[model samples]
Target: MALKQIWEETNMKIIVKDLSPVLLQTKNVFEVADQKLFRYGHLVLPCLSQNYGPTYFCKLEKIN
Candidate 1:
């Protein structure tokens, strides 16, 4: 909200250096922001994630 207030109509991006699938699969994990992104954005997994061990790096492109 604060960010949007400062920079309206700008593209927003979230960079996750380390995201574990295991953590996301947990029953207690529910992030509102992540949920919104998953619902309104397209998930993109790069080839580098395949070789980077258990964690992954991904991007989300908004649906507009």
Candidate 2:
């Protein structure tokens, strides 16, 4: 599913490169942000390098 679809269905807000307490998932791993956040996924991959690469998978949801 598309990111927008996921957001609408899950009612979650996701901000790439923005620090927040939102949920983030990558390659089956889900992480709850406590600090800085980065953008990942298909679109972000091209701009990323080997040292700092984008996550292959991602999922997010609201806390409250």
Candidate 3:
């Protein structure tokens, strides 16, 4: 199923972390996560990239 459909049906929340101020301010972090989730069924919690720095946390949850 498409990511949007899956998202709507499951009502899953995408959790993002370790985003820099620029990314947060520009909402690029969410764009990255959304693209990743759409292209791939899942994404690595903490991306191993210098841009994102270092962080070890991630969570995907369904709305109750």
Candidate 4:
């Protein structure tokens, strides 16, 4: 349900170096941001990294 909604809204292409599947699974657990507050033409990734607590890594493209 959430995935469908995400696909419908915007493109989600991110790169998490050295990130395991466990981290990937954890990454998806994000509450949708308020559109009014957030800027347009953007993709937000709410993540929990070992160094960062509840961080956001916004990506607009897929890089190698």
lDDT of 4 by residue, 1-64 (tens): 3444666785774443432333446445543334345443223434455333333433343453
lDDT of 3 by residue, 1-64 (tens): 3446767786566533333344456454533344343433323244456355333223344445
How does candidate 4 fare on TM-score? Answer: 0.22
lDDT of each: 0.38, 0.43, 0.43, 0.42
Give the top-scoring candidate (TM-score).
2
Task: Sort the predicted structures by TM-score, highest score first.
Answer: 2, 4, 3, 1
The reply for model 3, stretches above 4 Å from the true place, is 15-64
Error of 1 at 14 (Å): 7.2
TM-score of 1: 0.19
Clashes of 1: 0
Q: Model 2: which residue pairs collide?
A: none
lDDT of 4: 0.42
| TM per prediction | 0.19, 0.24, 0.19, 0.22
TM for candidate 2 is 0.24
Residue range 1-64, candidate 2, lDDT tens digits: 4766857887666643432323343423433332324354332333233344344544444454
Off by over 4 Å in 4: 1-28, 40-53, 62-64
